[model samples]
Target: MHPQRECDIQAAPTHLITLGAEVAATLSKDGSLSEVLQICSEIIAHYLKTTNVCIWTFDQKSNTLTRVAFGGKDIYTASLPKTIFCQEDYLENLKARLLPCNFRNTPFSSRLYTLVVENNLVGAIILFGKEYFTEIEDIVLGWIANNIGLAMERFLAREKQQNRGETLLLKLASKLRHCLDFNSILEIAVKEVRDLLQIDRCHFLWYFPYCQNPRITITHEAQDSNLSSLLGDFSAERINTLFDKIRNLEIIRIDAVRESSLDLETQEMSIDLGITSLLLIPLKTHSGQFGAIACSHCNGSRYWSDSEVELLQAVCDQVALAIDQSEFYAQTRASALAAQAQAQQLTQALHKLQHTQSQLVQQEKMSSLGQMVAGIAHEINNPVNFINGNLIHAKEYIEDLLELLHLYQEHYPNPARQIQDKIEDIDLEFLLEDLPKLLSSMRIGADRIRLIVLSLRNFSRLDEAEMKPVDIHEGIDNTLMILESRLKGSGKNRSIKVIKDYGNLPKIECYAGQLNQVFMNVLANAIDALSEAEEKFQIQNMQIHIVTKMLDSDSLIIRIKDNGAGMTEEVKKRLFDPFFTTKPVGKGTGLGLSISYKIVVEKHGGTIECLSEPGKGSEFIIQIPVRAIASFN
Candidate 1:
């Protein structure tokens, strides 16, 4: 009652404390630690009436206190120390005491000093001017320190929680990387987020291109029967609107799901599901858009914290990346498999085409042979008919002459002078000797005609029967017979000498008709070359040598050689190619050697090759397998 204030030290107002309480409460309520720190610094600066206030935090790596929060102008100047506090300046002192000391005269000097926690010195709070310090000033400084320390502790705790959540998200992302199934990964992501964030409901929706409506609903913990039924048919318009809003970095906070009238159907469905709050985040990929993740909270109103939104965004990014990678891998594998299948199909088609082409070529050869057979038959008919008629007339004439000779013997029993003279004139001894020789010659001519006809028929062996046992000698003989006229020199010139050196062989199972064609082609070519050379060189010594031998129980070998102008290496190379020939265009069809090669090698499962040199001659060797092929029937 007797106290009279010397100085105007008025009692601090309750409203001032109330205002500080309100400011502190507002700062503590903020979701972001950075904003909270800025708000704390503002409160401190306003209360202290200082031109500058700086908040610093410890940097463990640099062992320094770095400015984290600052208020007022030009406080962060160019000439100030990079760090206001350092371990070299204060760490030793800190190890020995709990309170920070002022260092005004030392290199690490500051005007303000404070302790944050025991053995965990946070940082120094710096204020300019020491005259402003007093009892009330210290109280204010203590309150500032206490408030900042509390805020920092809370901020650190929140940071650790956020880090743990990020770590779990990364682990989930790693698992999602191994998975290609979208639904399974989505389920895992939703379940993890629901449990980790402590939300009541979590659902995922996938947007499909060109689809009018696409949505997937999920419920966690509790399900409303009506809501469960209506979830499947939930309107996609709400999702679209939500996506458009969030795509622009706008946060959509629906504090009360029941109160939002924007999507009536969604609202009703949420009410049915007993959902009080819902947060939906869009899932986007690098290329384009994917869909969205809808997380719901039941039982009470829900506010989406800033950290949760950040986590959901991260998870959505991870899911999008994983899905994109999976789709890429799936498409690549499919394309590879499709290419392989196409290659296999092309290979099969090529094989069939080759087979059909071979068959067509064989048929063409047979047609050519048919035409040749008809021509040869027409040529042989005239000679055959002449020989037959001449032999018949000659037989009658011989019989009548024998009877006349007997009659003459009876009529002229004793020789008269005229009769004896006539008989002497006739030269009876010569007639008797010459008659037998003339008849034998006629018979030989008839036999020759018959043999020629038989050979012609055998050469055109058209029977399409199964492979049968065939005599190689017969085939060679038939070929020679058909080629004999060509072999003999035309217009009374010297004939080619065909030297046959045939070894003893057994009948081998083979397509006789095809083998006959092979022989005919080889022998005909040899005769033609030899004759052409003989005519060209005017040298009559033309020769063709044919040799046959049984190589083994399973094979037969044939060689045909000619002493004619040999083929060049270039000609030899294309000798077996269809439609390739050295002969004049009209003289050869160019298919003879090609067809011969096919018959000897492909049809008979044998080999045909040539040996020749320019200025020498040409030789062709054929080796045939004698084993019978199994009948397809």
Candidate 2:
């Protein structure tokens, strides 16, 4: 027998020391309150030689005792009272210092009785053995009561601690949900797990698909820098190899580790970092994928509790939710930014389109003015030319008439009328000479006035208002006539020649006034180009060529080619651009070609292009569609 058992047997006859020791050892080994009570009943029945042994736990709220664990030889077990005695019944006995054995008169048969301390009357142990109980047996029952009470206390403490941990985890989850930033939430989760579970090192590894590796992003690391270094280089593969056995399992706990259990690499790493034991938990989210959290102890191996695993799993859930939210916010912000940029680009394009439209309208107006000027100038030139020529002839005739008058006056110097009676017969010569002189001078003045009136009427083409089908050649002819005076001015003496290769063509539908303006602009530009040409040799062959042709479609093609100082590619490129001119300041508003371009192209759907090269002459081709454009109603 065990020494403690023999000492109990020597003390009392009824006591069974062996049964008491057996019960205590059973409770200690099992570490469970319910199992401890069952062992207590079995020990009393077999060793105390009792017919019945029943254990009842107290319900403090109901002030009653109820059978909780019992074992007995049948004496009609159904008739047994579930409640032995209430707290009120025990109150008087307890105050009078009467032993619980005094309650034997009631339905209960047990002799020895004890209270289970779970808030007042937690439970009781009733031992009914053979009569004439020995002192040793009484002592053994006392030991059983003490051991049961201690076991119940331990169970209650453990339960309370578990409930507290669960509550803490719930609070942490609530806080994590409120956070929008993934990193912030992760950091908090790591720290809370470490603090709550009292772990030495805690690290969260984020799985990166692109790299095929796990990144230790957030950590509540220990003080050892070497340990951190060891963990930093640890890869997902190595971790998998170490924990391969438990990879697919749930809640794996390694209570202890031997040096031989660690692979060579892990062992070496642990030596450097002074790590003794490690706990690796696969963090699973609601979707059922695995991330990992690694905790290590530098001092010694750790036995991780069930509560610790539960807490970590709770944190992992929160982290997954937070990360999802963060990604959603990022995508939403990016979409909004892209939409805003597109809107801005559209607005800018609209503004540019409006500006171009405005420029087109202004150019159209300038083209119209150029046409009217060309027409009026052409009409005025014909009369001006006639008047100018006649003026010179009239001057000559006047001089002759004046000379004849002077001669007649000298011949009949005095008293021609008195002597006229006698000399009347000779007056015929004087009358003839004087009358011829007077008639000659009057004819010269009348011719000059007629010329002025004719020039004035032809200068204004008031007859054509709206557009009409007209011969383009006639318009060119009229333009040249009007500009004749300017063309024949001192500028012409510089040897500028105009060549015309006008093709025979039928009259076509066109804005006659506008076409005339086109011709004037081309001619004027040619003249300007000729003037700007450097006087290299004798300025002889400065020529402007104008060609006109009728196309198969009844459209007209007018081309003006100049052999002055021809334009370079740069000049030709911008020739039709509005507000671009090479003419001297104030001499050109830069609208001539621009206006013509718009009128022919935009209004009539014609095409214009310049063909020119450096040192080579430039040709501007204008192809106007003969068909009138339909009006937009």
Candidate 3:
């Protein structure tokens, strides 16, 4: 709205203004690295009167240069590969020296500038032209390089913050997933957030805006051991003249509460309590906002960063979700209890009806989900198979092309200057050596995807949901395949090897789908326990052994044992109890083992038992009848 910028370069001073303004404008758009490079390259090339401008990032791990974006005529020509082979002697020399170098006047006058970030060579900016750059032009190029480096740093920081926020949210959701108790959920939410952010004090204040009492009552508080607790009620009526504004705010951050425009009493209280800064985020869901989370900094007047604010907001969202889930559970349990108080006959009738209805609903949902997975797998298989089928031909075509190029080089060693320069620019020698490796990598990736698709089809087993004589080992193997990633461990968990000892046995008559669910839940639990034990107790030798065999030829037995931090007898007693668990509030819903028990004992006329003691690992033994008591059509 203010003014429009001219596209042409005017004077030396004007060049600086134009370059600065263009780079600033591109950066302000916050598009992507490609857009920034494109705009900057155009401006730099225009000012320097260069024919071409390009940026190639250096990959230190592979010792290669990847061309990110470029601006010029014939930029996408076949004379160059997307990746510049850094094995070339010219590049080796330039990289070793870490300095700007220009080529002699041959096909064109070209110069290469190193883009260094934090003493590490991150990239290269190449400018090609008929005329070399003047000293003034070099100065302008340096200015552009500095701006580009700073912009890249900013972008990288932004990406890291975004990734961290995502990880934090995922962890919060996972930890609170099994939690049903309102108080327990609140405790975990406050403690998790306080520990993660290293905040001095974190408290959840319950408040209902619609109520006559605008009182903020602290339900839960997590603070440093040295810090005094603030777990009490406080009135908010006089706190803000515009209470609606505070209620609707995404986040209310006071960097220096002592200097803030908060009520005089609030400011005085904060100063007296040694609170430098504070952040209040309203906990909200689709239903309503019933509370706010207060995070305080007591050390000094801390500047609340945008990332920190976002993290707190995400944590508040998780808490709100936990609250909503807790309320839903309470309502559902109340309804079920009220129905249970009817006449004995009616109560039994209702119980059977509800159980049958629930079973039907669960089966329907599972069937629909399995159908969707099968459909997706079918759609993906065809395309992947097509790629795999043509992959060998691709390799053959590349080999033939390489052979032809080799023949050309052998016959005509002394080519024209233009052809020779083109060869060097394209780094054809490195390409010939790397072409097969690239093809092999693609083949490996395709094979991995195909394996994942196969695993999906095996695990779902939608057709085998009804009673059928199926191989139990196949179900176990499929579950293991799906859980392979968790077993291999990651940044936060330790790996555990699964030892399978299967005695040759005929296919057992049972519900294959239900048996598969049991295997998944049991195996998943063992892996989770081992992972937690690995981090907490620093246990290096973690293992889970699966043994299956026919017991007296009438029944089949399976024992799943793990060398993890064992549970006490008390835990073992309640291990199969419904809605009872030892896991953290949100981490477990206590239904996995219960379902497994019902499937093994009630449905299959089998027995399930858990044996464990402190310091000794837990073992779950499941025995099922092989010969069915009912006839199968």
Candidate 4:
């Protein structure tokens, strides 16, 4: 039978068995790239019966080769050319196929190589010895080559990520030492590092102080248009619950987002914003935090490394140092304020004070903004640190499974009965499919946390220009969100229905923040009225109708109407009067409507009035010039 047909010679079982036994140990996912590559060289040398086995990597910047690893070396050579691997003929050979070539200048010895890392043909094995192989031997060499390729793909990706993170930290630490401007610290740091990392976006989110929870707002953001903009103050409900990891200087990394511990709403919101994965590293000390440095991946998932985590922690240490240097004298600011106040001479101060007062007002607003941001940073730091700590273990687990699965296919093409049983027990196919979903979840979770911080940042934008075109609807939306819980339900268990009839209107020249406050006052009052009516009338359909439309060519109108007991003529007449309120004793400050009226009328060159009858609901009508120019200064 053999004489008749014996051409189907397969690779020996010993070749497969030897590779199977060593592959897992040599190319373990947890092994460092250098360590694995070195082991790979040693294994190949042992099998090929050559002591002159070496791995040489190419340097693209310079036409050079760098020896990464050598096996059973006893040959001393100071005459080796650095650019041997980068030569045109050498590259052509590598691209063509695995082939032998003359070694050095001697035809007596020979060399052959196979591609290792694919990134710019990063490296390859150089078998520097006279060798002739049978076809089966060549097949074994091919197997090792393919294995090297797979190992390089994973190891190099991780290595690249780790190196980038290290470079970022080192540069940031160095820059912090030389940075002189304390006021613009957040802005400068984020911009510099974001550019250096070549990431889609970066931000330093600060926590709001007045809120009881870890409510956050973004104070500084450096971003590209690759992702949806996250720039606004978000409600506390949206904040991520993983700041503890960040507090411990752990870095949170999300490689590929699919499913996560975050709520569905939050995940959806992140997807809406076009963020896929991100890294949140806390800039915190034992005492407190400066904020977190968020490196976002908008386009796809990216592997994060332990080296990257440590590097970020070091960077955070430097950030905290800078913050300490910058904010260490915060207590002395009060004394400085008192000194400035005493310097104000009455008559001289009046004119100078008017201009200075406007300046001071803006300064105070910024100061408040700064305080809120600082708190947010401190709050979000811990959770991000916590997430960072956990992510390492999670990644290792996933990598272990993937490595095991890969080895099963590569080494043991025909798995034993016990191995097959285990695979079936584990439902290997389903596990493979589901493993990636976990990463997707983590990515979604990280993105959700980022979105909250972004929103808060957007809400805190302080325009230097006194009169600029701004979205009034955005301001209203933010205000309504702040009071969302109150409107969602009342003491009587009745939900308030808010009907918004917004019309297409051009962005009006206005103070965006001030307008937001106006919306807050009006919306708050409407909610209060609805709550009262819900209790008094036991009404299930409490409603607040908000309408915004173009009043004329150059003006816009806003109307807030409540379905509650209406105000009488006397109440309506005194609604805009200072210190006037129909609310029961302690509940009524009465200045809310009065201040709101002044904002719409005197400040923005607008008109405001209450239109109501005693038994009917009340409607507050406001009209503002769309393009009116007013100098706050």
Candidate 5:
């Protein structure tokens, strides 16, 4: 013992004994290491009249001494090292001594008492502003340091146990950080937590907070052998009660259901599930709660440590983050698919609109042409009829006059010298012979004009309203007559010969004007094709075969084929697509064939298709129902 402690023990032995008893009693309590140290510090300071006191713990791993508690004056400790390296000679020598010297250069006197337990350096206590110490005071402090060392040993052992759980939590968090799948995250979390804690069962319940009444679903579970599953055991009413607590971000820990403050219903339900103790950690972030993780012990009533609760809560946090990430990924993928579908629909709509616009323009042009042709046919038909009627009357009057002249010639053969002079001057014999031939030529010309006017009226059936039964052959013939000028080549080229294969067909019910327009379009295209072929190939034979036949009782077919410069497969594919033309710009409007298709297919509820190959003839096949069944305006 130090000389000063010996003097102190003799001067105040009872007070010294009392201080030792109080310090021993404080360290013996089942409180935290810091709490006990703080109480011991106060007791020592009060009895000794010390100005400053601090307790430091020793870390053998790092060879450092760290101040764990300070119970007195703060100004003295402000300049002192909160942590001191044990590698220093002064601190290294502390492990072998009961009373170490105060080596720090301070304004006041200082003392250091090294604490040892079971032949190991656990911690120490330092006192400042104490100029001298009696023998009894030194002895009491020695007893207090010993008690503090023993208390630190117990606390360190408990801390080592906590570190084990913390290490496992860190490892589970590392695995979770690498995983982004929601279900996989839940599976890994529950299994690792149950295994680490050695619990009876562990499960994850999933729910969405945004719903009116969110359902808590058991998504994943891990358990020991012979344990009953809690899957599908939570009813909606039970979930509501359970979720109310979870949503508050509370960690509900029931060490023993019968002893805990939980309601009877929860206690009974827990017992039914073989759960004597339960720990539930809510999975949440700053946004909102996602779900909860339930850990249960079924063997008997078990106590849940703080370290265990902390480990499970940390794992649940990682699970919530992974779930949020997966939900975002799924939403992004769905949005991309929806956008692609919408883009395709828009492209199709635009194509349809273009076709409709082209068809409307073509229909307008055809309507104007039909009106003009009907007017011309009307104006010319009357004059031609008048000329035709007067020719017959004039022929009869000239023949009667010629017979009278002949009778006069017989009655007065030598009577009038003036008449004889007129006959000699006018060449009477030639005049009588040519007069009848002139009348015959005039009558033939008038008949040709009448036939042309009739063909025009037939081609432009503008006066007819609604669908009616009309001669299909007559429509074809009228279209042919209208295209006669094109069929005849302009210069040295020969006329395009048309071969008609008329079939025995009944009168079909159809729109007269529209059907006539279809025939006109087909014949016009045939003439144009033959003209192009004549210009390019220059082969002598140019023929268009117009064939009509009764395909069945309800339908009829018309085929107009031409020996022309037939189109390639590429052009044929878009042959009836509006505004898709092989002809050069300004020469062709590109709507002729498309409008013809609409009139045949849409207007008449019929079918029209083209078949052709390069250098071969092109054929347009139209199949119309014999009796038009489609109602129209």
Candidate 6:
């Protein structure tokens, strides 16, 4: 080599060092990756007196170059493309010869410098200038390129770390939003912070802000298994410095307790608790409650990064809001429970009131009808008995008179003409033949009247005020007799047939009057159902079947079924509810089945249910105890 050229190589270090110091100052400043890269490009462009300078970071995984920063004259920078391929035609000649070359059709020549760290390409810098680079300039550019590579690597690592912290903080916030329990929220906050920062222990300090010289308690703790617990209570004065900081809503970070500018006592106390490094993030909720989270390092001193501190502070803020909401919920829960219980009680009382009203109305109607029927029966019974008794004697007298007339007719062969004319006028022989038949018909009519009086008296059961042994079948039969008018065909309506399947049941001890009322209600409902069906579908052969059977020694079942239009499921569900009816307003009172259910189930300690389906039929099954329980009676 020539002597001057060789000397220039030795002189290159002094200039390179000056340029390197400028680049270092730019990298050290607090700025984002792109900003720092732009400043670096500007510094290099000024030193070279170039037209333009641009930097592109290369991603080895993608094998692509992405333009990141630009500096130099605005006129030249505006025309530059934001990205280009590493193997583009313009770059191929530069890569092959490792020299400055004209880029595309531009008048100025461009030099491509690869920025490398650890002998691997991380990025490239391009410079546009009129003059080619000298040997010393090339050496200085290589040094600057290496510094840029190192800066890019450091910023990339920091960005990745920040992204990770952000992800964890987001996860913690999402979990806190779903949590309602106070202690659980605190536990999750501390545990997540500890795991995110990889610390030895984390705990929450709960304090009341309203109290004078407030006290604090370590309410929740999350730590490594090998560490001792920090669960305890302390007076406010014990850690006055910490309390003051929390009151101010300040974060306290101590890299090493021994080296921190804390009071001597706090330092010693922290050491005693085996804390080499500590970070405390204070929280103040909207309701004025205050708390703090303490993250500690027990094994060795730890450097708490800025990113970690920021993430923990964010998590603490979310936790404070959750605690405030949980406290409000706790206050409202008791009132909610009380209101629910009161609602239940009111519903039950209303149901009882309705039942009592229906019972009173039904009893009044039944009592009035029974009294009228009894009065009519009594009035008719006495006269019918009188006529029936007299007819027996009258029949004998008529027979004797007829026999004497026949004897006279046989003995007096020669009768006067006047006697014969009188006989023709009176029709004597016809009278003798028809008179006895007339008396017989009168006796049968009186007997029918007596039978009807007996049925009316049986149905009323007014004499039996208390429960007594009664034939269940007799009460049912009486109810049928009363409803006979509804059963028979009239006009266009078809007759509803009655089918009875009586079982040999023993006399059951029950309230006969009330039991009879139940039979009346059920049979009346069946007749009404058939009547409606007759109009709608004109059902032929409509029938109501009365089935009775002894289920066992202790109980008996009475089933009353009708082959009429059945009810829907929704109607069946509320079938026995009081004042619920499908009939026209005046046609039905709607209390029949409800009253029957109460009498059978509540009064007699029995069960009653209706089985029904649409277009099929409905069946009411009532099961009563054989002997009435003493309490029910």
List TM-score per model, in order: 0.50, 0.41, 0.46, 0.44, 0.60, 0.81
Q: What TM-score does candidate 5 get on C-alpha atoms? A: 0.60
Q: By how many angstroms RMSD does model 6 differ from the true structure?
A: 5.3
Q: lDDT tens digits, residues 225-287, model 4?
A: 655567666555654553445445456677765555555665665567676777787765334
Per-prediction backbone clash count: 0, 14, 4, 35, 9, 0
Model 6 poorest ten-residue lDDT run: 94-103
Query: Candidates' lDDT values, in order?
Result: 0.69, 0.64, 0.76, 0.67, 0.79, 0.83
For 1-633, candidate 2 gives per-residue lDDT tens digits of: 358765865674433556766776777674456666776787778776666777766666677666767766755356556665564557446322222334344454345456545345556666554465655666566656766766666665566556667766776677766777756766676666666666667776543323556533333343334444333444545445444433453444544445446566656655565666666666544445445666767776687776667766666666677666666776787898898999898888875564475456654664454455556556666675676577568767866876886786788677567665755776755865676576566566556545444433333334555556777787777677656655564843554556788887877766666666677787788777766663543345677788888776658898888876677778888898767898789999777787777667876777888888767767889998776766600
lDDT (tens digit, per residue) of candidate 1 on 109-184: 2335543665666665665432445554555455556667667777776787698788868888888978887567
What is the descending lDDT order? 6, 5, 3, 1, 4, 2
Give per-residue lDDT, candidate 5, residue 71: 66
For model 4, where is the 10-residue window of minimal lDDT? 1-10
Q: Pick the candidate with the highest TM-score.
A: 6
The local lDDT score (0 to 100) that residue 228 gets in candidate 2 is 48
Q: How close is each model in CA RMSD to the real structure?
A: 11.3, 21.6, 42.4, 47.2, 11.4, 5.3
Candidate with the larger lDDT of 1 and 5: 5
Give every collision pair in model 6: none
Candidate ordering by TM-score (highest first): 6, 5, 1, 3, 4, 2
Clash count (model 3, backbone only): 4
Judging by lDDT, tell me the better candidate of 3 and 6.
Answer: 6
Superior candidate under lDDT, 2 versus 3: 3
True-structure lDDT of candidate 1:
0.69
Model 4, residue 373: displacement in angstroms? 76
Best by lDDT: 6
Worst 10 residues of 3 by lDDT: 1-10
Q: Model 1: residues >4 Å from true position, as ranges?
A: 1-19, 22-39, 72-79, 84-123, 153-306, 313-354, 374-460, 471-506, 515-626, 631-633
Whichever of 2 and 3 has more TM-score, that candidate is 3
